[model samples]
Target: MSENKTSIRKKHMEFTPMVPETTFQYADLSIKHIDAENTLAMVRRAIRMGYDAVAINIDLGDISDYYTELDMLWTPGSQNNVDGEPPKKKKKKQQRKDELADGIAGILKKKLIPPPHYVDVSQLNTSELEKRGKVFRQFSRITFTANEQVVINKVFIHPTILSYDIVAVRPGEPSVLDTLSRKTELFDIITIDHLEEERRKWLSVSKVMDRIRNDGVFYEIAYAESLMPATRKNTLFNGRVLIRSLKSKNIIFSSGAETMLDLRSPVDVMNMSLLWGVANNEARKMISGFPKNLLLQAECRGTGNGDVCSMKLSDAEKLAGNGEEEEQDGASEEKVVVGKEEEAEKVKAPPIEVRMNHSQYQALLQATKNANDMMKKIKASKAASSS
Candidate 1:
């Protein structure tokens, strides 16, 4: 029991919580699929806990019908404009027909609800609107995939900057838009795992962060705890490099947490910030102030009144040396072994043929006989052909 206690203590000392700068909250906007009351409760909890911001994910499955209905409803009035006109009983039957169509239109319009803050584009389905407008906002924001291509061609390429993920960029390759036009810029908030793979393939996180910092692109980095286990080495290394190299003012720490269950309490994230060298006030600003400001942009205020401790400097310095040496050494050794010798060994091995399961010596004998038989058959065929 005493020995077990000592072992447990040692393990505890070695354990470092894999917490990062940001946590992201993912929210589904499906009114029917999601329990509204439960969702509100979770949102309230997140608000109380001080989570940075919530990412509202609107998938195509959620709003396909809405968009289709909207398209159908707007098809009739594609060119019609209702000017103020008095009611005439002579046109009562025509008016009744118009009234019924209008009633149906109203219902369809109500049903074609877009995601919050999203502007609907299905209504402005005119060639004139398309030509005159630089970009039109899609009414059904939930149809992300179907509308993404449309957005890129009609919206992103326009003078306006659209805030959707560009699906075209592949690993180790420059963005299609990047190669095509200097004026067009691609921005995305990739997972730490994806970023790590990209970093490994081309540039380090510091290099990427530096480029973004210099380029002045508006972007956010969200920390995913679920991805942490799979991306342990890259997460720690990249995060350390990023925090060290990038200006704190440029970096936005977010909860990349997907659901309410996935979220850690704001206090927990605050504690994580402390671990990551953030002062309490600075941590509060990153978690609450920065995200609200960026998401709300002009409307949100920047002042964050939170307790900040002066001991953060000494505390960070003290914790700086924790497990770094072990991680670096382990990563280096693994990379060296994986890169060189493994492929060479595969090429050097000779191909062997065997008919059936047998003893090792029997299998060898069978393989030898098979090879000799094939050689003899080849010689016989050659002789026959010559003759």
Candidate 2:
């Protein structure tokens, strides 16, 4: 098997093989056929692709369908159980003994089975992932095919939807697009999931672009779609038009891969951006800075307030050192102040003297002379009147 591009880089770079912190992978982990083991494998492949972070996306629209299927499986007299009754006691005891024997056999075989699909990220301890400095963020995205004016309210208030780290909206119709173009706190991303023509037509209006920009919402281009032969042409064309419309201001590039094969490296993504009309600098940011800012904004929303500090370990360490220094300096200053208070009996301030410059003195003299001259004129008038 060929070594991963990341491992190749490590060989050349001669180091512990660190992926750039800006590299992120946004992929679908909730697909119908993707089990937990498959999802973990996809994440591992992403890590090999040099992604420092991965966002597991759950589509809000698809979740209901999934649960609905699950419900159908539990129907009365379903194949899953015999009328929902407990297994026979004799069979249960025999099955338990057989399972114990199978468990011993499994241990001897060194076979490890993954947890059930129902186990979400919250249920797992991520200390090992943290040790690798790898982060997994959960995002919920909903694509609106029409004006879901009625359902929009329910979607926003849904507890599971609100718990997601990020909420992205993809409007499929003009009415929905226009509604999304306005300021609303319900979404962080205005993803461009339409065809080439539709993307161009919708983004042609400057007002819509301006509103999206004003709202600080990001535009997303899912690269995995571009990798698929069927959707490649549409993806490329739509991406080019989207970059032209947004001018790479608030754009993010996500893998959107349902499987590991669809994943690409961050550098490859930037190179792909060049084909989409995004400049090299902006392209780099699409995979890095832009997505990072979007995640930060999403975090602020999830926390219900934007006023918070998310410091890196290095930054926290530096601040801790500075705080200690400040404490020492403050203690010394306090001691000095106390000593000064004890040593000094009484302190008095010298009186402040007021002085006029030559120009000011001359002006004052002129004013005094004018007053005396006026007074003398009044006295002379009075004497003349008396005479």
Candidate 3:
């Protein structure tokens, strides 16, 4: 118990208050699946390598019959033109239709499972790693597979999709990329699958990349693809094009590993990024800073203009520790003061020995015993009266 208290105090002393934790120092934001055991092992491996977070990705095959941006103009709470007068009833007819469509979409969404969450950092004890000042956070991500231009505005607001912390779209059409690049609120990341030859054309020129960057959306590079023989050349070639276009801004590297074997450490990914002509600092930022901004952007998409924040538990924990320490210090000081006062009261003259006849000695001893008993009774009475 003493050891535990000492260790806790040491951690609290080292902590910085209100300063944001470097939670995104090394994040594997794309973990491919939600397998119970395999994902757990992969996350454990990631944590061991100092990754702060992972997003369990669930594939959204296609977003169909979603409410469009135009539809919101007629809805009760219009996303745009809030200062303008409420839309007339004639304009609201379309919103009513969209609401009916939304009902159907909600019914369809009922069959879908919400993203899985793993609250434990380790198997042994959840608090163990926290005590050691390390944290592993898990988030849910939905990667929508967009195969058409209509797919962009066609995404329905499914409850499950809204529940996810990250929204990543995999576009098969260049039009989808062009559209999503401007509408940043719709998604957080635009992921490209390097395995397909045609997917190269999906990235056209600097125009789309500029819009994406201006909007604060990140283009994710799955580093695991580089480990493949056939896809390696394409990954490098296209990656170079993206870096040239975006100038290494708003780009984040994630494992996107389907299994533990495909997983690469952040250091390894940083080294591999050199092949794309990214400098050391830029490569480091890809795993740390860019992803940090990406998560903030994602949370904003879900919360709109609201003041929602995703903060580490460590800061709040430090506050609680500070409060507890102050209380303990005050208590200890009070104990010291009380001890001194009690000692002063306990001070008394010591008994002196004197040679005497046995009878005289016995009488004196009895008298002393009676006097001690009387003193104890008087002290008890005084204590009761004081209370």
Best by lDDT: 3
Q: For residues 1-387, what per-residue lDDT tens digits would candidate 1 score against the true structure?
A: 667534422210011112332222322111111434444444444444533233333333322233332223333323333465445643564666687788676565643333232222242233432343322111111122221232234322221112221211212223422321222234332223234344333224445545644543323334555246775556555544545565555445554444566456656666666545666776656655554333332111122434332334333322222223322322211111224546521111111332223233244434555655687799999999999
Error of 3 at 229 (Å): 1.2
In the range 14-98, model 2's lDDT, one tens digit per residue, is: 1121355423343332221255676666666665565655565544332222111111222222223345565685466566666
C-alpha TM-score for every candidate: 0.36, 0.53, 0.60
Between the candidate structures 1 and 3, which one is better when assessed by TM-score? Answer: 3
The segments of candidate 3 whose C-alpha lies over 4 angstroms from its true place after superposition are 1-24, 61-114, 117-119, 122-132, 306-387
**How many clashes show up per model?**
9, 0, 0
Candidate 1: TM-score? 0.36
C-alpha RMSD of each candidate structure in angstroms: 29.0, 20.9, 21.4
Instruction: Name the runs in model 2 displaced over 4 angstroms.
Output: 1-33, 60-147, 194-200, 302-387
Q: What value of lDDT does candidate 1 attain over all alpha carbons?
A: 0.37
